[model samples]
Structure formats: C-alpha cells, structure tokens
Target: MNNWELLEIRESLLRDLAEFIEDNYYGTPAPHEYRRHELDVRLGKKLKFSSSYPQMTIRQRRASDLLLQVGLCGATEYALGTIEDEDQLKHGRERLVKMKGDLADLMRDYDNCLSEEERKLLLRQAKNNSNREESLKDSERDSLLKLVIGMAVGAYCYNPAALKNDAVSDITKDLEELGISISDDTVRKYLIQAAAKFPQARKA
Candidate 1:
C-alpha cells in the first residue's frame, strides 16, 4: 500500500479503538481513564511485538502494526486534549509495566540481543517518551485552563455572575465544537482559581 493508504488504515484503527474505549468504559465524572489504562497495557504489548519483531507471523505483524499506530495516536491525543497529568502519569506507568515484561522476555529469548549500551539506550528512550507524554498532558491542561479563565474573565467583564450561574456553558460548548471533551467541574475549578487569583479584575 502507498503511504496515504497506510496512514488511512492506521487512523481508522485508532478511531475504532478510541470509540470502543469510550463507549464501553465511559464513566460519568471521568470517562476513558480506567479503560485507557487497561487498553494501553493490553494493546501496548501487541504493539511492541509488532514493532520489535515485524518478522513474526503475518497476522501477528499486522496486529502489532495497527496497535502501535493506536498507541501513538493516543499519545498525540494526550498532547492535544486536556487529560490531567495524574491520568497521563498513570498511563505512562502502565506502559512501563509492559515494557519491563517485554524487556525481560527479549533478554531471555536472545542472549546479546541488545548490547549493554543498546539496553541503556532503549530504557532511556522509553523513559523519555513517558516523561514527554506527561509534560505534554500538563501543557494541554494548563493551556485549556488559561483559555477557560480568559473567556470567563471576558464574560464576567460583560456580565458579572456569567459563569457563576451557568458555570461555563459557553466554554463547554466551544470545547465541544472543537471536538475536545472536558468536564464542567474542571472548567468551574479554573474559573474559581482565576477569580481568586485576580480578585481585582472583578467589577463592582
């Protein structure tokens, strides 16, 4: 398949996995957090097999390939969406759990499979990826908070108690339009924090 076709396949797989996770494992206050942790451990193993040993059977190779794409898509989503740092850290830790197992299996199966330097390199790479993901998630949350507070401030300037009564309907609507899901409680928390931090900004 061409590059475009490959990309299409990958994107399709990621979308299906995301839908399955959300639909089956969605919670009221928090959706997909638990489900994603489970899936990451399960599918990350499949993805790693496909990535590390593409020469395995064709079916195994294909499955792993698709899973790796899904994992990358998930990491990218964490970067763009407002998933909390704790949630991201949880996911990262789950990934490390699988990685530890996979590394052990690799060493057992093949002596000198990865040299000492190479082993260190691989561990560093994995640790760096986890750190980067957590950082990106944090950045996404902070940016969303700033945006919510900025919008709330503008609204409060126009009409005091704009967010107090409705509590960020406009923010939620805007996020929905952007295909970003965030809890109302999170928005309200940011609103309160902003108001408290900048009490002077509030009009009499």
Candidate 2:
C-alpha cells in the first residue's frame, strides 16, 4: 500500500482504539462477563480476566500504553519507509528518531506560522529576560565578594598572621559556619585582596 493509505489506516486504528478505551474504561459500567469476553476476543488471547476494579484498571492502562508506541511505529515506518533498522531500530531507538523528526517538523511549522514581527518581538523579549537574569547574578556576586573581603579584613585586624595557612584554615571554617563555603585557596586570595584594599590594617 502507498504511504498515504497506510497513514490513513493507522489513523483509523488509533481513533478506534481510543474510542474503545474511553467507552469500556471510562463509560458506564458494562457486565464483567461481557467485558472480559470482549477483551479476550479483541486481544486474541484466552487469558483470565479479574473482576476487581483494580485489575480492570490495570488492563485498561496497558491498553492505553499501546496507543503511543503504535502511533510512533506507524509514523516512523511511514517517514523512514520501514521500521527495520538492524542497529538503531531496537529498544525504542526508532521511537526516539521519530520523536526528533516530529520535533523538527513542529519547529518548522511554528516558524512558518508566526509573522516576522511576532518572531522579532519574541526574540527581543528573550534577550531582555536573559540580560535581567545576568544583571541579578552580577549584583549577587558583588555583594558576596564584598562580604568575603570584609570578613578577610576583620580576620587580619584580629591576627597579624591572617594570610598564613593556619589563619586561612580558621577563616575557611568561619565562612562555612556563616553558610558561605570557600576553599582554603579562595580564602587566601580574598585575604590578599583585602590586604591590598586596606594596607593600614595589614601594617597595624
């Protein structure tokens, strides 16, 4: 059959499957015996059916789960001419390929559907949002740096050996206690910056 004919058939099958799930699972209750028999006939299996509500729900959910895979395989087969790939066709790789192709098609359609002015407006809004977020991050980083420098200066005033290894270890622990974790190396760097900023504090 032609690809168009195959797609049409698959669409009809999906519609019928959806209707079956809705009616039997979501519609008014049917006789358990009848439902069980119907399921057996449709599935071509002679398995037992449980009368409990939970068991019925499980079966219905299983039926619904098949809908997506069936649709994916149908679309993949139609687009790729066949669903038979030796290396890339097993274990849902084919579905992933189909999903990526569908996403590309959707993006293309979205671009085609929007006007040039609308696209430009969206781009401007995205850029503005990104810049605002970057500005906020810079402000936060500056505040944190100032706080660290002040702490480093205070430690230097309290102890003349503030930039030494033991002093840096103590500063690192203090920063951790204040919920600001800094490595010993970073603490030493901040201490050096603080000493440069406050030469009098280092001399005193």
Q: In candidate 2, what residue range of length 10 has the lowest lDDT sum?
A: 44-53
Against the true structure, candidate 2 reaches a TM-score of 0.24
lDDT of the candidates, in the order given: 0.48, 0.44
Could you give the C-alpha RMSD of every candidate to the true structure, in order shown?
13.0, 21.8
Residue-wise lDDT of candidate 2 within 1-204, one digit each (tens)? Answer: 232332332233334345344345422332222233234334322111333334433334333333333344433433332334655446456566666565445334434544688556656655665565457565665566566556655653434343223566576566667766554444555566555544555334
- Candidate 1 regions exceeding 4 Å error are 1-148, 156-163
After superposing candidate 2, which stretches have Cα over 4 Å from the reference? 1-150, 155-165
lDDT of 2: 0.44
TM-scores for all candidates: the values are 0.29, 0.24
The residue-by-residue lDDT of candidate 1 on 1-204, one tens digit each, is 222333343343444345223354333433332244345446646545445544454333343445554444444434323334777757866765665455444334332433577446545655665565457565676666566556666663423344223436566656767778775545655676655554554546
| Residue 48 CA displacement from its true place in model 2, Å | 61
Winning model by lDDT: 1
For model 1, what is the alpha-carbon lDDT of residue 183?
Answer: 50
